[model samples]
Target chain A: MSESAIITPPLSDDDIMKLKIGDRVLITGKILTGRDSAHKRLFDLIKEGKSLPVDVKGQIIYYVGPAPAKPGYVIGSAGPTTSYRMDPYAPLLMEHGLKGMIGKGVRSQPVRDAMKQFKAVYLAATGGAGALIAKNIKSARIVAYEDLGPEAIRELEVENFPVIVANDAYGGDLYQEGIKQYRR
Target chain B: MRRDISHEKIKDTVARLCIDANYFLGNDMIQAFKSYIENEESDTGRDILKQLLRNAEIAEKEQVPLCQDCGFAVVFLEIGTGVCFEGNIIEAINDGVRKGYTEGYLRKSILSDPVKGKNTNDNTPAIIHTTFVPGDKIKITVAPKGGGSENMSEVKMMKPADGIEGVKDFVVDRVLRSSSNPCPPTVVGVGIGGTFEYVAFLAKKALLRNIGERNTDPFYADIERELLQRINNLGIGPMGLGGRTTSLDVFIETHPRHIASFPVAVNINCHVARHKTAII
Candidate 1:
């Protein structure tokens, strides 16, 4: 019922403050991609007080593992994977200035708490919608963890990528609010 | 009268089924989405359903996977007692999985080991369930199950005294607790009775039924209807952003259990629900 808000990442406090749960968003520009294995490796590096292969500040990582592209395609079917598996690494990533996450399913309470504390928000694309979602990705190149295969950290150039604000910095949660609205 | 079936027939059929199942969703599921879209109250929920339908269309037209997970290859094989296979059945099926995943560009999700194993690179060694039947033909069904929804499955052994209320409570509780984790607008496959492991298999087998199809047993059909309604009341809409269409359908499969054991399992399947069937 509301118009989708356009957002470009490296989101500032002011930008975070303006978003709300349930608001539709169109994200453009570059974003990062990773899932369970990649997150685990990054989490350990942070724990060891070592520098990361890529900087985390002002970046949004999509929890996705894409199918391989055929010839003449920028990427193959790519959609958000469940976010819960990466719960252990999220709060720490937030602490390191990861401003946003794009994934599906519910996050742990700690991740939500970190969202409020760190001014990060969790967004969701339609789950199981791999092919349609991939159309928005203009280009993709692996940035790190190539051996991880699909779980590798790939940087993506996306335009008008559709998502919904599932969790906002002000502690608004869309999943709970939607359930509350319709629960009979 | 016996009919001979070579391993090549099965291998080629499975390889083709694997690609088709991942690339094209069943029409019944597309109908479910069309109907649910009309009834889903949330604007977001309806939009998500629309996108899903579009995703399926694109997958078919583009010859791509419906989901990136592509899933664990679960094959259901029913061979007639009069049919004899010429080669190793397991090897043929594995060869099919490897061929399909590679040729179709689907994700190879299997690992040689569970915890510390390297990727198999080619998805093979499908989770196969074989049964002997009355006819001379062989029937094959390939259901590629995604991990997101599969992780939400559970197996619980309840006391016989726990009764119907306990079973209902467990099914509802699992979905409620699951929230959007399994991907919303899921299919709830309930397997009741049998041993713990058999119950789990029943639950997954229950998923092979078409969406909105009820169990043949009147008693289970009623339970499926009730559970479906109760789950929709939870308001977990599409993608778990909250909506009235939490479950596209609920299916219950029952087997006779021992006097003391009442094992029940729930296998959740996402909206994409990919499966295809072929007979040889």
Candidate 2:
């Protein structure tokens, strides 16, 4: 369980497939947060040729709608929601320079195809590990869609974020592989 | 002889229950997670279950929610015919929900329209089910039903010949199809026999039972055990990552049905199964 093995440099499709399930990743970098409502707004903004509140180029986005923060906290139990809900808007975001996604569950074929085409990756934080995930966020600020409340797009600074590689840029999906291996 | 209960008490109780249930995964759920971890054959699945267990501990200690999807509130009330309330019970429940969402920092996941996608701020207008019982006290149970698991719930009116085997098949099929989507390992609640709507209601009510608890009836208890074993045999495992424990538990509640009809409903609850009850 070498750290280097798990932390492969973002790779091409063929290279990503070489990695298997159970690999742990300590992701360090910029990742945007969005859920269903925010995703719709983002795609709408892109469709209108309007500027996105945050530039998505080479950035990862986490699909989450967090609980409201307690008095002293920056965010509440902030974990991944179901990724399927964002399936409709994901490819478009990938086309606009989004390189990675962090959420739970399986992705649709279109989203997988987008990952292959854009050299992006899909990572998954545990679905219910909200408080632990929130600990990774050092700061947070609302970027857009204030009316959406918890679903709004927020800029967050993170450190050593934990995720499992669900889908890699090379079109390898851990979900499918894992299920196949374990299916009785 | 109805005893009067104030609206304020109702509001406070609802708010507290909502926050408590969301922030803390019950002991039974935690035990199920541990069992999943110990029995899971896949390394990845075991790791995922371990993470889930740790997540629960973190949420409990920190007083933060166990999941981002705090869920739409489903409140079940068994009110005594002998108890009377001064104000509207439903409105008080909504007000408590508002305060709970705002002050407790739970997510307001409820939407005004499922199709139009209009969010009802403060997670208002709970799906409340009330029944009158013969006690002098009112018992309230709140279960925050998450969308992922809720979407997997289904009700089917099968021919009387379908019986227990048919029920088992349908439940397993649904669980297998769901895979990682509903955030396994999950608790499957089965409601059998009753009418279509009553079956669905029974399925939800069955979820309130503690994990691994058997139905009082020997016949249904055996069915529950068999279903639990079969579900685990599917190898869906934790988070569908692969394990020996795909389901934490399977609970069944049954009622008499028309001779021609056999209705069954299945409701799935994710690993972060949250429910709490209070009496007033």
- Give the clash total for candidate 1: 1
Model 2: lDDT to the true structure: 0.83
lDDT of 1 at A102: 97
lDDT of 2 by residue, A69-152 (tens): 888888888888889889999999989977778888888999999988877778877777787788887777888888888888
Task: Report, for every candidate in turn, its global Cα lDDT versus the true structure.
Answer: 0.92, 0.83
Q: Which tens-of-lDDT digit does each residue in B118-215 have in candidate 1? A: 78989877999999999899999999999999999999999999998899999999999989988888999999999989999999999999987888
DockQ of 2: 0.67
Predicted candidate 2 versus true structure: per-residue lDDT over B227-278, tens digit per residue: 8888888877777666677888899998999989999999999888889999
- Categorize the docking of model 2: medium
Model number 2 iRMSD: 1.4
Candidate 1 local lDDT, residue B239: 91
True contacts kept of each: 0.87, 0.69
lDDT of 1 by residue, A35-120 (tens): 99999999999999999998888889999999999889988899999999999999999999998999998889999999999999
Angstrom error at residue A59, model 1? 0.6
